[model samples]
Target: MLKQNLQLKLSQKLSPQQIQLMKLIQLPTQAFEQRLKEEMVENPALEGGKEDEYEADEFSSDDYDEYDEYDNDRIEADDINIDEYLSDDEIPNYKLQANNYSDDDEDKTMPFAANVSFHQNLIEQLNTFILSENERDIAEFLVGSIDDMGYIRRSITDIVDDMAFTQGIYTDEKTVENILHVIHQLEPAGVGARNLQECLLLQLRHKTPTESVDLAIDILENQFDAFTKKHYDKLLQKYNISEDQLRNAIDQIEHLNPKPGGAYDNSNKAVEHVVPDFAIKIRDGELELTLNGRNAPELHVSKDYQEMLQSYKHSRDKSTAQKDAVQFIKQKLDSAKWFIDAIRQRQETLFVTMNAIMHYQKEYFLDGDEAKLKPMILKDIADLVGLDISTVSRVANSKYVDTPYGTKLIKEFFSEAMKNDQGEDVSTIEIKKILQTVINEEDKKKPFPDDKLAELLKNKGYPIARRTIAKYREQLDIPVARMRKKI
Candidate 1:
């Protein structure tokens, strides 16, 4: 069935200027430094450091008309169009270059590239393989289908159908399977297989066989679910293998790469260093917060554009076209002024909110102790800063603060508090910390059950329910007592 409908909807949306301000307000210190540089490169009106000490009085907007006429003549001589220039637009030559690491720095150069771009590597290898042009094309296309984790998300049927429809090439399932087999034989060994079983088998085929290797393959091929779910008792009974033998076989299987694409990660190199946006230092028993100054470049209005506007205003003027030019110049200048003001506002707002957050979490920042972190939410910060909750959340989400303790995500400071048996409020993070400690010390042969954990917590004054304990355990990715059980 087909349906058509018309509805009128009214929505309040931020203008480009407002949206830019919102983004600016959320940037942390280091990011703000980069952001300022970007604005300096982009908007001529937003100067980075300071205005010139001595400039002709004619540089002001009041003389914009006179400058415009002079600029118009020069622009026409140069065959440059005025329409291409915007008051808020950045100059072309001042692009910010990414920081390059010096070779002398040991951490800067790694033994292997940080991330292995597997799919790209496979395609490169496929190019070296001896194949007919058509076979090469097909193999390349298949290689392209593999993802970073080294799995072909699409089915073979879907791929064949796509090729038939788009490329007009008839590729059978068997040919695709053969190409897949060859791909699996590549360095990573298990990349192109359709399922886990195939992925494991491809890796196993390369290894020298042992008695347990064959058994492990059988276990993987037949009872993969049981093996994965840690149903060791059932498997031991089924195979009549002792626990030590089973462990060895499991180790052998675990040694295989499930995704062949994983191997390529070391060979390819694209890595970025973590840049903390805010810096905090304690001096004279007070914490001082500063936005990183590196991100923003000093910007100023281009003298040429300023001169054009000045000249236009100076001319008592003549034609309708000249009047129109004057109006256009005024509009662009206004836009540029508005953008500069918004950026300034964003800077002030970011400082105000960040300062409040630092003060609120002063203990944690000073000590680098997670236990010292007070329970806080967006509303608490918004209240302190006299801003909206949403605004506070935005600031917290993207920003990072470098404390004496360590660089941490700003959001790590915020946590919901729960009331303990003593009626004292405690952060969920604190509870989680205690829970982790309890589990870490528990006997491996008989791990504490969730109910038992809850009872222990209650004895310690938390008074949480068994269900709450279970939920917290899951959040920590801790298995149930049975799953945690060990020989």
Candidate 2:
């Protein structure tokens, strides 16, 4: 059954202006400048300049009531009337602040340069190989199928089918495999292998053969599982080699690059540099925070647009054209003022939010010590600044700050709290730092397992379990102790 009832409800929603401000707050310096330029292009009444002066003339409320007749961006032809507006000499007043960056301030140059793409380099190398036209087409098609990691993700059969249907060139898996063998011999030494094992072998085979190389290949091909699991005893017995020789062979394998595509010089793509939105400096044992002025843009209403509104007011006929002009002028003025005010509020919010973060992690800022970083969350800063959690999140998500230690993403300063054996709260970041150091310094011949790591931390006053240690290790992108083995 369908039923209807009347009930009162209270709901909250963000205004368009608020939404715009939120978006502006989240943008890093580079994106923010691009956004500012876009707004200036769309809204003629809004502009960038060094002028610091602004003035306005007041208008009656009844005059503005006429604007309510039109929908947003809709101007009625018949109902439009200018008889109610002011005389030729008078102009409408608006609320606004002058937006400006200094004309004399020198612009900071961003560091970037183009690099050759990985696929393009491979194609150029393929061009050097002499082949029949059909062979060349198949080779080119195969090269195109390779991924960023320098491995062909598609099957040879799929490539063959694709070449038949899309490229109108039919080829079998054997022909594809033969050509792939040729690509395997490319400069990267492992450019076209199907899997990690094959990739490593390709690189090793390309090098001049030696006793150590032969042993490494035997280990890789025959005892990969044992070698990867660090079953050292089984490997030593099977290879009939002393621990020193196995270690040397493993070292040779370790020197080979696994991610061959990463070895490519990406000179075609500009090296992107993170431009921090904030900077923290220490003076007189005090922490000072400053917004990177490089990212901050000055915005103001266009003076010319304001003057045009005034001009329409004087010597204006009570025609639809004059009313439409007034409507357009008024809309632009409102947009400009609202945008300028939103920018002002954005600056205030960013400062308040980041200042709170700076103080929250004050100890770390003072000493540049990861151990000193306190456990903080988005809600903590949001509550302190009387803002919504989402607002604080947007500010922290993409934002970066330059500190005494080095540049860091704003969110990197936040960590969950964990208690020590003494019942004192400590940062998860500090615990991770300690855990990482222990792993890095452990004897690689026999790396510390998670349980052993937990025990070690427990001895050092951290109350953690084996599972917790494993979780932290995974978060740090470190594999298990078995994978960390040297030989």
Candidate 3:
């Protein structure tokens, strides 16, 4: 089997610089800002105005013409006044053009950013009770076990076992139980419960005592599956409670917050604003394209660098060390040129690819409808732009677009099409839409099972299997009919 073989194959691989360019193109606004700040920190040549210089240098300038001609920062350009000579009585012929604001406008527009985070909420409630460092550590350990949904899915014994093995902290069942008891009493009261019974019971314990609430808790403890599955008849005989009383208790239980940790302040977390990598505007039935301002500064081979290179080359009377120094400068100059050329190439390639996308989905952008989105993929754009599919993919990934209707992620317009029995291409997204509509309209008391849903779709001409229906349902995060059932 181990015979010598000779085979010829053609292959292509992206250079490291090309790969870096692709990653640079794909970053959205917030990440791009952070990246820009990091680059300014790293590279001395690349810089914006210093923090202290911003306020003083802005108003201390009388040469308005000079500022208009040479201003590099796109954001700072917005502050300049073009209507300096205009008066109230004068009819100004040349209107001042407004600069397009960055997508970070929404972030600036928002009032408050505080939405709850999982950890902060737990920590606040934990601080109210005093404990020794070890006890607090155990309590913190227990709090960590609770997930986003606020259920401690792992057992206390498992936590003790993990502490002894992984953390090298030997803890017993009693310590964990005491901590669990404290955590279960924390706000969003049902948090730290190991199972549904414990979660609901912890919630009920905090409620004002009534016959029905107590009875409901007992029913949940004894016949959880029946209660969950909405077997009201079996529960009625078991508990001797009327439907009205049962409904009341269920309502109260439903009102309790399942995840307390989800209610804490989540301030100062920066959200990503969809700054489009490319802009396509329709003016008088013609499409106009512009690269987003955030992509780069007015970059060129630095004039200082060019002069340094020239001075280094012109020096003839030199020692071996001087020649070596000249050679090192020459190498840096070459690298700088290559980088400048790569940047130019990147701009050109981006424009070409976006032009293709605009042409491909012109109807969708013009009208602003998902249904108008045509069947498009990487290959379609690649062929149009005269680039390989992989190259087109690099451009499309993590990019966004702004339209008259709304800003959207550019990748959303591209979806794979599935052929129907009639051989017509239909988008998989359309299929998902149909599935969502069906689920929304279905009777909750007797929800259609996956098999029934499949048959229904087949009757309506989709003709998919039960397995496929199940897969799609799961993909949509719609639980099974049994889980969906309600009284």
Return the top candidate by lDDT: 2
**Model 1, runs deviating above 4 Å:** 1-19, 27-117, 127-138, 153-162, 262-269, 295-297, 479-487
Ranking by TM-score: 2, 1, 3
By the TM-score metric, which is better: model 1 or model 2?
Answer: 2
lDDT digits (tens) for residues 87-142 of candidate 3: 12221111111224444555445465555467666877799998888888888888
How good is model 1 by TM-score? 0.76
Per-residue alpha-carbon lDDT of candidate 1 for residues 1-487, written as tens digits (9 for 90 to 100): 9999999999996666667777777765556667666755665544544345422121223423323322344333123223333333333222222213232445344454344366666777776677887777678778888877677888999988887898887889888877777777666777777777878887887778898788888899899988877788899999998988888888788788776665567446455456776789999888988865443333444455566755655556446676566555544554555455565566567668889999998987777778888899999999999998988887788777778888888888889999999899888999999999999999976889999999999999899989989989999999999878664
Each prediction's TM-score versus the true structure: 0.76, 0.89, 0.73
Better of 1 and 2 by lDDT: 2
Model 2: which residue pairs collide? 88-314, 99-299, 114-267, 114-268, 115-266, 115-267, 115-268, 115-269, 116-267, 116-268
Give lDDT for model 2: 0.79
lDDT (Cα atoms) of all candidates against the true structure = 0.71, 0.79, 0.66
